[model samples]
Target: MWLMWIYRILILNHEISMASIEPIILGLEGTAHTAGVAVIKGREVIVNESATYFPPQGGIHPREAAIFLAKEFPILIDKVFKRLPFKIDKIDGIAFSQGPGLGPCLRTTATVARAISLRLNIPLLGVNHCIAHVELGRTVTPVDDPLVLYVSGGNTQLITFLNGRYRVLGETLDIAIGNALDTLGREMNLPHPGGPHIEKQAQSGNKLLTLPYTIKGMSFSFSGMVTAAKKLLHDHSIPDVCYSFQEYTFAILAEATERALSCTKKPSVLLTGGVAANAHLQTIIQKVAQEQDTSFQAVPRNLAGDNGVMIAFAGTHLFNTGKILSVEDSQVKPRWRTDQVQVGWIE
Candidate 1:
């Protein structure tokens, strides 16, 4: 009878220990051309894997990209599971990028997330893609509260956290900075993603040609600059045009960021998103941070781009804060703005 009592005690302790373990979340990202999957145990990222679809000729065709994500997501998810120390059933919740992204791509990812959540009988979290970027930047960097400069193919905004949500102080009035770069890249016959190539050519460019500098209040427009830069290509070398393009655009961004920092008095400035990979942008923003007497941080190149890890981290926050959603309510938002999300976990 004493042996039986000891066995029961041991079993009870094991159950309690299991219950005390931190929750694990699986995240999926398929907002555009990239399909990603990652696993996070509490705040630690266990595995992150992704595959990007490159258009054969021009920009991403939404349907084609969706098909690619549909095919690649399973493979990436399997890869993540293989690298994980625990089994698939051990996942406590599922999180996915809900929006704002291509409709087909968002649907594909949401379907996968729903399937996983239902199969495992776990909570489902629909995370905002833009908020995920900011959250991940905060998690990996030393910044507590920051003035965020979010730049990417589809978005360009100067954001700050206030009250219960991220507020946009400034944003692009026309095309996003990354899209403008890619458009210019298409004009130059460069690859689909034009930012890196433009940066490369800008290194050798000596001439700073004329380009429109549009800044109305806190918002800026890149479409005019892009058009003018394209026109300059006929009379100037690619390198010179690229150089002038970076100088003008990055300067505009730095100016806006500085203004926001000064106005908000944020202790730090964080640069994040796909365009955050540009060294020139980083340099310019760093300078602005120094001038404002605030610390500066840029998302690491690997995490700067869209990935599943950010989504997972954001999802973990949502799950911990009781933000789980039912499958029926987990719908995609193609035009979800940055300020639309209620950032309940920040406070």
Candidate 2:
């Protein structure tokens, strides 16, 4: 009781005080091909809007995506303000995804966030993109001390909390699973963002072709498997190859997640990232969690993707916890790791 009181009185952080007294926050996210804006009041998202760049031909070109974000952000910001019930002056703070993403995308989002923070003179917070995803799962679900499986186009890792840090217990050594799938799709001459297309094909495939399964210690490797699948694409049916590819890849992640759970013994397993939208991977992770006698969680399909809501949600927490940044310090970090964040709100 005394400690709690002392913490409340002794903690002298302007941002944390503002968060506790004020209830509204504006958040921005453009860590990759998506540019978004969100308004968070207390724990609920009052406004969540995003514009994604989908290249008609190949994968996302960084420069093109940056240009697209530059064009679309104004429209998205306008949409949020025009639709909001309250005035813009009601917002208490501003937040943006600061790092662990593509350089151009991160810069575009950060620049806007900085401009807004200065214009409004509100407290500014730079959020971690990976940490934002985990925060989204927490906002929409009931999970505490969860072991997280974060998979996306640029990242793949099994993470959990211990000793005041979100630790990376296992990760991909080379390309992330999402990128590997996209690359495979490119190799097969399929469209960009091949995850959905691959999922569709894998459903019809009954055959499971033999592919290399690489798991080092608790980490995952998909580069070799992708190469081998490219070779077999000549003889095997596309559906069958896609099926085996998913099975192998998803199983590897499931196994690594299971190991993380066993090591940490956390009661919950939260599956997130763009790939969490996959039905097969969800089933596999759910099964692993159930078999381990642990709880399972997945963000709703809408919240499963990258958006400003997660970044905004994380911003709210960080502000309350006294993590405010100056405009000069609020630069983008394309290679920031999740484990480096000091999680002050989570207990």
Candidate 3:
């Protein structure tokens, strides 16, 4: 009991000190198709701008997306500076998404971050992309400690903070939920970022065709569902397939989330990442939270998808904790896992 009391006191002190000082940080995020730049003075986002690359056909091509990000980053940075009332030199640090992303994209963004860090003679902080999503969700919402449902294009996991780290309680065994949706969308001749398109079609769909619902313990798999959905195209209506795809996949996610919540018993549940913007998934997870009698909040639509603001916010926390990185040591990790990062900024 004494140890717990001391820990709470330390956390309170940290919060107070952080609230007293507002440091300016410039953050860059180019993990995949989006190239984003933003500046933040503490929690207030000064300017956040991003450009997404949409292939003419098919999913993201790493080389092509890297080229697109490299081209747009300068413009986005310029836009951010122009929108700021103060000079760019006021920034105290530069933060970039270090990894768990495509190699080319991560390198492109890291190069820009390093250049700016050296140019300004400021500290550089490498942030984990997955942790940034959870931090961003926490920043924009009222939930202090919550079970995080991070669903995106390349990754899906249920995360919660414990032992000074974000622990993964559950994750996808095969392709991520977003990837499955996009793949099915492509097979249907839909445009890129199939989540929105699928959601639209699913609204008109009254029937739910059977699709694979693979969940073992806390982990789930979407590969089977994607394959089955594609074959269902031959005999089933597009709306029905889309609706069924969402129902089965989202139900699997909701069940897993609920199970983790039951075990962790976090105060709330946070639905983040690009796929979190889907209303159907939000509804399903919200219902789960309701049944558990816990609060639920989804990241705002503006911050739901990948953005530089998340990097800046999380970077600010890391910077305050003195987790600076040297240019020579700022190498990107394509397979960096969330559990590998120590949450020094948090308890």
Candidate 4:
């Protein structure tokens, strides 16, 4: 009893009171391509977490993704808080990507976020995952009212938001650019993750090989390009084919983005997604934007990849806009639309 009293006294003496936190936000990302989580104190991100799960086959497996998240979620969050380099008590709220992604994967992320919010007794905010990427990329860029072109493993398209609604200016009529690159890489017996490998090989490649550079009006098609490139492999070097393919496909994207700027009367362009890490793609887009006399915005290489920081940043934006999600709003919809967001996001 004497020892227990002494321990209690020490604990009480060490306990410190905290001030009211000024809206620290946490963001959850478990969409189609990457599973991640992030913590933000106002505009600055304290901790951003992400993990990659590559399937044995070509694409993502929902069941396997859920299993990976179940294990990684707690560890990542613990690592975040433990290594926070700042006060943990200042975290004010929670934010998460609510929809338009894989159902099983999103459920795993949402379950974790909901539990965290309950434990902290903080408000939970729902953010659109795509919009978060756009906002974060824009914040880091010098573009103002720019036409945005977002291309990733799961998404590929041209977009412009007008009057708080994101309008699809043009998009892939078939497979996404990354999807096509991955398929081509698999055919060439490359690694599981194909984008970087293909980009590396393209450096030595010549544009002698011919690939289908299909562009129909504002929309584009990469399926035909993948097929054509595979056929050329028998006659041309892999590097040559890869180079030609990059040139052909990125040209489509650049042309579409440029056209969007002209139509919207905006001389700025923002690029995001995993594919944005490609130096060739960035150079091409920069050249196009420069030729058109428009501003170009591409997030840093670290930020471009799917990470928790973007999610947390996105969630904080939602919280400030009064877009909180209720306890009953836990349903995970895999195919949520971007324009379906009714809340006032941008002015």
Whole-model lDDT per candidate: 0.92, 0.88, 0.93, 0.78
Better of 3 and 4 by lDDT: 3
Q: Which candidate leads in TM-score?
A: 1
List the candidate numbers ranked by TM-score, top first: 1, 3, 2, 4
* Residue 334 displacement in candidate 2 (angstroms): 1.2
Candidate 2 TM-score, C-alpha based:
0.93
Candidates ranked by lDDT: 3, 1, 2, 4
Model 2: pairs clashing at backbone N, Cα or C within 3 Å: none
What local lDDT score does residue 285 receive in model 2, on the 0 to 100 scale? Answer: 94
Name the candidate, 1 or 3, with the larger lDDT value: 3
Q: For candidate 1, what is the lDDT? A: 0.92
Error of 3 at 270 (Å): 0.3
TM-score of each: 0.95, 0.93, 0.94, 0.89
Which residue runs does candidate 1 get wrong by more than 4 Å? 1-21
Stretches of candidate 3 above 4 Å error?
A: 1-20
Residue-wise C-alpha lDDT for candidate 4, range 89-179, written one tens digit per residue: 5666677777767788788888988898888777777777777777777666666667778888877878777877777789898888888
